[model samples]
Target: MNSRYLTPLTIMSLAWLSACTPTRVSNQVSIDSPAQWQHAANAQSAETADLKTWWQGFNDPLLNELIDKALAANHDLKIATARVREANAMVTGAEAALYPSLDFSLSGGREKRIDRIVGVPSGQGIKLITPTADAVSGGLAARWEIDLFGGRHLEAEAAAAQAEGSQEGLHAAQVGLLAQVATNYLELRGVQQRTGILQRNIELQRERLRTLQVFLKAGLANEADMVRQQTLLQSTEATLPVLTNAKQNLIHRLGVLLGEPPENLENRLAGVGPLPKATPTMPNLLPSDLLVQRPDLRLAQSEVSAAAASLGSARADLYPKLVVSASGGVGALAVGGFPSLAESVYALGSGLSAPIFNAGRIRAHIAAADARLDQVAANYELTFLLALEDVENAFVAHRSARDRFSQLTEAEGSAEKAYRLVDAMYQRGAGDYLVVLDAQRSKLAVSDERAKAETAVSVAMVSLYRAFGGGWTIHSGIDKASIR
Candidate 1:
């Protein structure tokens, strides 16, 4: 080969080799962390499985209907769906950079120039006539940045990761909505049950007050006892308003969750009964299951992946870039001419550019990306740990509440029997009025405690389902199906 050509080829080969050199490797770490309760043996064998629709187990038609409506019309859900669409569009935009960009342009204009002689007599100066000319031009231009160092590829990869992250975020939003709706519904039912209990106790107190008044009239009980009974009845009556207010508040919250006004739901739920019974005991999976089913965790993981890709893209900027450009056009300068006097012009060219200096901006970007990846990795780990904590805490709560409900039920029954026996004795003149009063109070206390215990059990089950990443029918809804 000639010396000059050989030198140029050697330099080109060196540049190619430099471009091939590895600049950075991804340091993304897995997000899965073992639960505190999970044993080593179980951890090793753990694997994520498909998520199930756990809420259907409740078998409440009203709850099912509300959840369906919320999924369709809730404002927050609409926002999340819109975010997913925006992310998908961003992915498309990033992928577009991998190909050539072609643009078309057209222009038409006329210009006239007047010429006058300088430093000449006004009369002697000849007036120069200039003709107006019209120019019309149209062209197609193309430019492509050759991905010589994987910059465009890295950018596309980062964008794809972000899109996936957004999808996971949407799922997380759905899960949160499911949990909120369940919590609000359970609270509403609990309040209703409490109100019913209060009403029944108030009626019993009123009856006791009447009985005391009759005894005082018949010289069987004193005025102090009658007054005490009257006070108790009034106190019990006072509780109803507070309970009613709480119940109404919960209904309003549910209305918002369902994307409707409270008045609209009042009629629909007028006959709705107490909260459903306990959720069935489903098989509990291992903690590692969060990696697949917990959308927030997956979103964090995707963020880490995106950060790693971004680092790669930033590092690619440290090296040289290659670009190819081309333009083709047909133009005419003649006015009122269609295809006549038209001329064609075309050109093709290539260029190479390297970042020589930019006040350390490129290095800072690469470092920022690296830091972001680290931050995402840490966040992922934290999310995994938090998920594990949630599952174990929910499990403990469910078990504790379940046992408490059983014990309270037994206690309430015993109290009811004792109260009945005491009441009969007092009615037969074998016991004092104080005994009847104490027994009745005991019965009311036991009943209230039992009702509260039942509510706790239901709420705990909801928490367990949420912590276990269950509930929410992912496939039945329109957004779930049309999102992709």
Candidate 2:
């Protein structure tokens, strides 16, 4: 190389290096949130409990046990945890790309060659020559891609963000599973309560039927009235099986959620238990808190971060790349019976490649990356909005359910009083049979509604905790290995 030309080339290379400006995507996101929750205005003024173990507030030991088991054994949670591990491995791989690679190679071979001289003296006719050689070589080579524009670093950043997103996904799965287990358990207990109500009502109807039979035999009651009482008794009995089936199905679902067979929990849950009650007061939280509390929202933010890093990486592709490589080796050669000769060898080189022409291939990648960033940003905003919706909806549902349960409890007490009064009058032969029957029916209906109302309150509480991303903090140590 001539110094005259080398001077200009060196200057140009330095200029190129100086022109490589670091490009990065903005990761800051802002969301418009209300200062206070609209639905939380009328919430009860009680002490707020820890949202981490919100299920325990129901005071149901069985429910708490079931949730703990599900958290450790659920299949969906295991799968999500696996994904987190995989994403973490991908981060390591992307980071490795910024470092140099080294490899060692060894080879040995034998080569033979033969030559003939045809134009020698006529007396000699032809002269023949043969050469043989054995050669062995071994080397270590290394290559490194210089991070000129931070492209490799951006790739590692993208991978790290993805790993965080996957971790949030696992938390989301845990939240969902906990909610599912609680909802089903509450519903099952409610079903039992309703079944008990029906059974008691059937017995009352049976007693009434017997009384009517005796009255008819004594000519005090008509046969038609007795038959009507019989029909009511049988009708009440028919609904019992529906509740039975529902209870069985719920137990099966709970079993499956706990990673057990459908019938595994039937015996354990066979005994009827009272419906769980939710706390009257709601958790103390602000709208902005969801940014950190809700796993889905956090996951969405991570997605945006990963996408931004990816866009930056794509932009870096438009810049020139620098690779430095080196190799060192020893070679041995032997010819015929001659002593083997060994020589040391080494080499160092560098290459620079720029996208001089490709019909817009690099630009196309940048454009795609930009679009993905936009999409992820939009999704992040949407997730935040949806999280707000969840919390507000949960607030409304929980409050309304609690209120309904309170009102139904009052109604049930009054109905029971009325039934007792009517039954006493009928026993004294002063009240109509039809009125007695009506009173009994009202009491049963009110009791059944109250049971369902209680269940609704508990289910709503589970939803609220899920919206708040409860249960994840407590299970922070949870992982694929831990679960297994």
**Among all candidates shown, the one with the greatest lDDT:** 2
Candidate 1, residue 381: how far the Cα is off, in Å: 0.7
Q: Give the poorly placed runs of model 1, Cα more than 4 Å off.
A: 1-27, 35-51, 115-128, 335-341, 423-440, 472-484
- In the order shown, the candidates' Cα RMSDs to the true structure are 6.1, 5.9
Clashes of each: 0, 0
Pairs that clash in candidate 2: none
lDDT of 2 at 157: 91
Count backbone clashes in candidate 2: 0
Cα lDDT tens digits for candidate 2, 1-484: 9977885586457545534538678866667766788988733322223666888888878888999999889999999989999999999999999788999999999977655222323466754435478999999999977777878888899999999989999988988998899889989988999988888888878878887888888899898888888887888898988999999999999998999997779888988888765452357777776776778887888888899989989998888888878999999998764578999999977789988898999899999999999998889889988998999999999989989999999999999999999989999999987578779888988999998998898888888888888876732321212111
Candidate 1 per-residue lDDT, tens place, 1-484, comes to 8975875575466446545535545645744354435421232322223335566777888788888998888888888889989999999999899788999989988876555222323586854445556788999999877677777777888898898888877778788788788778877777777777777778778777887888889999999988887887788788888878887887888889888899998877655377787464543575655666678777887787788888888999988887778999988885332234679989877788999889999999999988888898899788878888887777778778879989999998898899899889988989876677678777877878888888788778778777766643333211112111
Q: List the residue pairs that clash in candidate 1.
A: none
